[model samples]
Target: MIVTWAFGHLLGLKMPEEIDKNWQTWQMETLPMIPKQIGIKPLPKTGQQLKAIKQLAHRKDVKEFVIATDAGREGELVARWILEWIHFNKPVKRLWISSQTNKAIKEGFKHLKPATQYDALYESALARSKADWLVGLNISRALTVKYEDSLNAGRVQTPTLSFVRQQEKQMDKFRPQTYYRIELEIEGQKALRVQNNPYEIKDQQEAQNLIEQMKQHSGTVVELSEKTKTENAPLPYDLTEIQRTANQRYNFSAKKTLSLVQSLYETHKVVTYPRTDSKYLTNDMKKTMKERLQAVANFAPEVKEYIKAGATVKQKAVFNDVKVTDHSGLIPTEQRASPAKFSNDEQKIYNMIVSRFLTLFANPHKKLQQKATVAFANERFVFTQNKVIEPGWKPSEDTSETTVQWQKGQKVRPNFSIKKELTKPPKPLNESTLLEKMEKFDLGTPATRAEIIEKLIRSELMERTPNGLQVSPKGKQLLDLVNPSLVTPDLTKKWEDELEAIAQGKFSSNKFLKQIEQDTKQLINEVKQSQKKYQDFSLTQKECPKCGSFLREKNTRDGKIYVCSNSECHYHRRKDPKVSNHRCPQCHKKMEIIEGKNGAYFRCKFDGITEKIPNKKDQKKKMSKQEEKRLLKQYSKPEEPEEGPLSIALKEAMNKED
Candidate 1:
């Protein structure tokens, strides 16, 4: 079988500028430039791959082909687009496998389905991409033209920005109200008063009067209750859950964790697909569960005991086919991996997956919970305590405590005091909480959420702070200016639902495209009529030499640039060292071309080495053919092997063989 691959997507929908001259310039008159015919073009980076695929597809010997890309919507698009672009007429089959394990791949190949089976999936993927292009491009251009500033709007990202901005607005308008509570201490043990609205006395005088009255009477333990509760082991890691756990435990960003897990899957072949949305495996996969468990136990010996004790007790909770979709849960494959072979980040992610898998087999955690109520002056106070009965799956999370025990009808005098407290605002969005909110709102899919967040940060629309993500002034302004529908999560939910329907063949792609076109036009019209204004916060006193406009400092993922604030002028200059194609002589890695006051030189960021390249006027002349030949010969001469103990032994063995 011929194995060929497209670099993700070899073709993309044509941009507005490519469609017509009128759409080339951002103008209100060109608002909502819906293409008469959506066309595809080869992406610059995928040119070689496209050429190779075309060459292979047209080969006379190659009578058939198999599509073995990812088994998801976007993955289907990546394969189908190339075939469409090449107009391939071969009999095509589909290889739909979720995990990268050899066994899974073999099974998928054995039961190859006809390419027609996934036609609806391809349509759904195409519809989603075209809709985004039409909506995001049109609205972004309209906003940039209307505000006279470079701004971006998207179907998924704008709504996410609104989430942050909404939280900030709520915080800004929040009023901290002071309230009072009474805490009674009996024999150095504290208990809080139990009320319908616990300790929320708004008036200080009333709170003081209640405290004084409570002090006048002795306390009695009115009730004591105790019970044992069991907490089931947590479900396996979906991409989102694992990302949040990695962030909380190792401070790894969601994007970083995703990258690490993807590497573990694609490079090491030690884990299943990393972009899966499901957290449960199919029932059929239960047959291999013991092998997978053994592989994990080999790496994490702490789980071996459970595996030895029979780890199939909770199969119902973990292996339900109904809960699985495009892919099964994130899991370790049967391939045994040496932790030493992985990088530190990779090791952390791998270990987390192994630990979570092991926890699924372990027993449920059991705890004894206690509650006590005390009465004084007709007021009741409650105390709570917990003690661990069993350290089950997750011993690290056990938070058992010991407290002074009290029985029913126990009486004692206690000191009473009123404590003041204030209401607090909602916490800012951390990567974990933000991801949770995105999942709840269906803002983006598991595969795209991290990229969406990174885009917002790259655009300087949001800033990552020590506490959490804070909305930038620009992000808030963008949220204020955009149409409410574009900034509400409901739009994304609607589109996502329609996309799923299209995938199921219940909805038509053409109908979805028509709706998107109408929405795009409405969004543009809203932008053209809105009276919102935007200020360039990055503008500086420096003037652009080409445009005679104020220069604005822009920070990009790669580096920084200074560009004219005038959107029309579009003058830009690099403020950071430019990455060069030249390789370093020492490290053989790409070097950066640094321009200093002295001259231009290539510097290796990895090794802190610098080499000066001669100016055109002072460059050395080329050597003659005879001189080149001599130099080449001198450099290519082979040296004799050094006589060491190991080398001598190897020479003696070779001589003996001769």
Candidate 2:
């Protein structure tokens, strides 16, 4: 029988403390907004779990080791890493299934293919890992060194940071300008959005004149039109879609909820997979919905009602064999489960997956729209309204997101007449909406999007705002420092098109990797050639020596410093730097380490205590030595002396006695 590991990573990585000295400082953070990276360190149970994993991986009697992981990239990698770390040499094959029923699992095992078939998938995953390691490690180090602060960086992170900072700038500059328009109203209807322009009256008094003019005029419909439209149930919820929605609805951070969902997939085995970007099942998966639905009869009693409702499971809504690439879209397995082990966040994700499953077989959601134009004072006003004629897959639920839009539209215009005004910001790009946009552009996959967001945050290239992602001051500086082409979404899109080619065996990973390597080098060289000096807002009492211009503190993507006023004129030589993980000795917190005209200093992340590196390191080491200076604990403890001076002296006297 195959053995299992605990719910954790088993190996192929150094122990946390071995990787870095600071990890031994096991003092928990006062504020645990994030799970510390080292907290991922395997526990004692993890070791026992790994022993089981290894024993299973090494069984010679086993004909073919089945890679039975949650069907996604991370799941694949997690299993692969364990096999690699344990040096398991058994022949391998994949047992792929979406649902949790024993029948599905057994069928999948019977249909298992050689593990080598997934080489391309593994290759892509490895590429992601190596690229993240190279870029995240190197760029993060460079920034930390320059800033004398522990700065984070990653491939997706820096650009994501830019995306956010851009929004922040927009928010900062936003000034709401009021506008006025004449609206025509009927006995039962409200006004609609038609032509909007300057008020008929120029001044506010004239605007009051327009309102008065509208008050004097009667309303009449000049034109009317009606149309009907149908929307299939939304495609399956990919990981990013789930993440974005979860963040929006529950105020769960993107990263926080990701971990929760991951556990739901791997540890709980209730969800099919959480890291997959594909939202459609392969054609084969749709065939077993009845069986899949039956498996969950214990928890969601609603499934039986659908079967009773004469819903015939259709192949059209199920998986498309041609569309399935490396992984299939997420779905819940047919496993009956108790919610006892699930955290609140996990329950939300579970509900979403189950609801979507039930929705697939429901009828098509139908919408009807009516648009009308009112001609008054030779100026036209337009009104529009949509009513849901039939709720398709979303039958039981009175409202979903799409439904809300129509509902809100109706609420805003109960009378269905011409409206005076309807002005709203472009739908704010929260985590979910942005991913939708990114997917539309085919910019990146689910596995990579989270990393991109994480990288931007770690690098301080962007940060979370109440509104959404925003670019950091440093992110702006770095974007300007680097060539524009290096950081655009186009870079990933272009790479994705090529990656798709490689997946089809039309191109090679080696060729694409080579091109990317070359591009990265060129990008770095361009940044190095820039003559821009570092600047910090705090460093203001100086002038550029060469330009004789007042030097002001400035913040950049790389760090902080002072530079010349002129952008084009020659000023200074370039220097490289890296971020430190070390905390400030004085403030006992991670410092805002920076490099520049003033050289390296550690400004506390919390306290704003700025100190040089020597002072920082010395303070910590000295503090540790002082804390260990006492022998009182040693004296009180049992079986202490190994070879103390007292023992040594006794040994010499004892030797003479012998």
Best by lDDT: 1
RMSD per candidate (Å) reads 6.6, 16.1
Question: Candidate 2 at residue 147, lDDT?
Answer: 44
Cα RMSD, model 2 = 16.1
lDDT (tens digit, per residue) of candidate 1 on 485-572: 9888998999999999999999999999999999998888888888777886788899888878899898876688998887768788
**TM-score against native, each model:** 0.86, 0.66
Candidate maximizing TM-score: 1
lDDT of each: 0.85, 0.60
In model 1, state the lDDT of residue 613: 72
lDDT of 2 by residue, 1-658 (tens): 5645435345433443455665433322211111123122344556777777677666667765678776655566667776776777768888776655565677877898887877666656555554444444445444434443344644454455555555556666765554555454544444633554542323455555545555455545666777887777767787788888888788776677678877776667777756676778876665556755765665565678766755355326556766665567777776665688888878888888777776776677777777666654555566666777887765554542222222111212212222233334443356766666666656557766766666566645666678766666666776655456645666666766776665556777777766766655554454445565554333345667787765544445665545664444456422323446666677565555566576777666566667676766677666553357565666667875579898899999999999
